[model samples]
Target chain A: MERIPILKMGKFLIVSIQVDMHDELALALQEDLAEQIVKTRAKGVLIDISSLNLVDSFTARILGNMTAMARLLDAETLVVGMRPAVAMTLVELGVSLRGIRTAGNAEKGMALLEAIVAQQAKSNAPKST
Target chain B: MPPKVRDTFTVRSDHDVVTVRQKARQLATELGFSLVNQTKLVTAVSELARNMVVWGGGGTVRMEIVKNGALQGVRLTFEDHGRGIPDIEQAMKDGYSGGSGLGLGLGGAKRLVDEFDIVSRVGKGTRVTITRWK
Candidate 1:
């Protein structure tokens, strides 16, 4: 079976969707990411979708579900690198992708992730006294 | 006027849905569709093709380059012999899904295309045709 690779980078997990994925593959990724999040105790997930030319309703739903699942697992997910055309189509298609953070590319996404992790760390830090 | 070209693909599995989307993009690109138009058409194809495989129990898709005077467009027809939809109006509503989906496939696909038509019979089959003109 084919699978999308997930790389663990320090406190974050990076998943670059470089191929046009079928429904099963997308679902598999969602499941795998959830498990990986718990196992790696990652703080954030960055999914790069710049290579995907299309994102239909089903794919959009899976992505949304992944975000929600990550939230449940104590992690934040940032979907990055959506092409302009895809963004236009997704909006017209009536999928708001609510609750999923997005960025223009991986650099911006990673920066955003680092900020989120830092904020989390600051809140989690013990009292200085 | 140039001769019209038509192609057909089977939609039996998830992989087939991806293939259909790729083909739609290729054909749209070949017909000089704008980048946005191509993406819209391919996205629409992905929704409709997945519908056939999931709800329609697998079917076939027909692609053709159509012309209306000065306008050239790509038309796709998705047909399935699975259990047909009982209420198209309900099905077209956003957030109304029969399965584990976002229930945006039919309605979303319609918004992405220039023309849309659907026909179905309970316990018979369903056919959806969509077109995007450049």
Candidate 2:
């Protein structure tokens, strides 16, 4: 089965979706990403959907589910590169993607991921007695 | 007004939904719909196609590149002989799904297209038709 590639950069895992993903493929990515997050102990997951022009309800839900799963594993998921049309359709489709964070591009997404991870670390740090 | 092109594809599984979406994009683009319109059509087809498979057991999607004088549009008819919807009004309302979905399938699809129609008979089947004009 064809699969989406996951690249590791520092403490983050970057996934660039370049194909019109089938439902199974999207589900597979969700599973693969969760596993990679645990294996690498990654702090953040950056999903780049710049090349994607359309996203259906099921795909949107899978994206949301991925971020929620990552959160359970102590990682943050940031999605980037959403086309304006896709964004509009997503809103009309009533998929809020509540827990997933979105950015305009990979640079901004990476920066957002870094800030979120830093915030997590700061919160988890032991308070001075 | 007659359609310049018409075709039908089966929607038996999730993979078939992808096929339906690709065909919708191609037809929508060829019909001179803008990128935004094309995306909306494709997304609407995806949602309805998935509903056909997950809720209706399986079905078929018919696509037509229609023309009414100077206006060109895409029309899609989804038909299934599986379990039909009982309360269409409630189903058309958001957040009402008999299956394990977000319940946005019917209402959201209706919003994407310019024209929408649905008909179903209890214990028989369901038919949903949507059209987007350019």
Candidate 3:
């Protein structure tokens, strides 16, 4: 699966997931996602996996790679709306999601991104005397 | 003809995934799982099927449905006698992935299913079981 580029919304970007067939779209999206990571200078990313059903080890690896790539671009990645069984199956495949932020749904994921961005901006901005 | 009630199908292959997927959906439907459950299970099976074809080179995939059992769901078992993972821990970690698939890796596969389990030996084989319930 090629990387799937993310869709931007303010400081947050949402990446669409093919879910069933991830190769062509997923990989292609990654280049776009990498580009966004740098261009947007966005605080965070929300990968919407709601449309996907099956993700092979290769697909899973790309996801990890994309997230790592995102981090290098100074953007945090959050994987959202993963079905319970998919989560379990991934575990058996010997993969875990430790660093990446996880959200149950897109709305909440976007919210989390907004909060993080707000906090970062607040900390960076000098306080008025 | 339709498969018998609560039937199980097991196959070994190195160049087929569509067949497994079709079989998985058929059983998932016969078992009477919700759309959510069916999608998850089908997706989960797809991951395992791909793994069996790729990493394992060739392996076995078993599909079973537990209609009246304690779980009342569907189960898939994928096992392969391929080169087992060297660093199971790191492999399972979120950021670490070895295959050419998705960055999500095994972690992503788990997220699509309901219940998942695995046991692997250095060279013996890797057995992964995933189940989706009502």
What would the per-residue lDDT of candidate 3 be over residues B27-72, giving only the tens digit for each residue? 7777677655665666667666766666776677777655444557
What is the lDDT for A11 in model 2? Answer: 99
Candidate numbers, best lDDT first, in rank order: 1, 2, 3
Would you estimate the TM-scores of all the predictions? 0.97, 0.95, 0.59
DockQ of all models, two decimals each: 0.86, 0.71, 0.20
Per-candidate count of clashing residue pairs (backbone under 3 Å): 0, 0, 56
Clashing pairs in 2: none
Stretches of model 3 off by over 4 angstroms after superposition:
A1-5, A55-59, A88-94, A126-129, B1-19, B33-44, B55-134
Q: Judged by TM-score relative to the true structure, which candidate is superior, 1 or 2?
A: 1
Please give the lDDT score at residue B17 for candidate 1: 91
Question: Taking the tens digit of each residue's C-alpha lDDT, what string does model 3 give over A24-112?
Answer: 45567777887777887877888888766554565566678878988888677888888776676566555665566788998898888
lDDT of 1 at A72: 92
Q: Which residues of candidate 1, in runs, are more than 4 Å off?
A: B1-5
Model-by-model lDDT, in order? 0.92, 0.90, 0.68
Candidate 1 docks at the CAPRI level of high
Chain B vs. true chain B: TM-score for each candidate?
0.95, 0.95, 0.80
- lDDT measured at residue B28 in model 3 versus the true structure, 0 to 100: 75
Q: What is the DockQ ranking, best to worst?
A: 1, 2, 3
Q: A1-129, model 1: which lDDT tens digit per residue?
A: 899999999989999999999989999999999999999999999999999988888888889998999999999999999999999999999988999999999999999999998998899999898
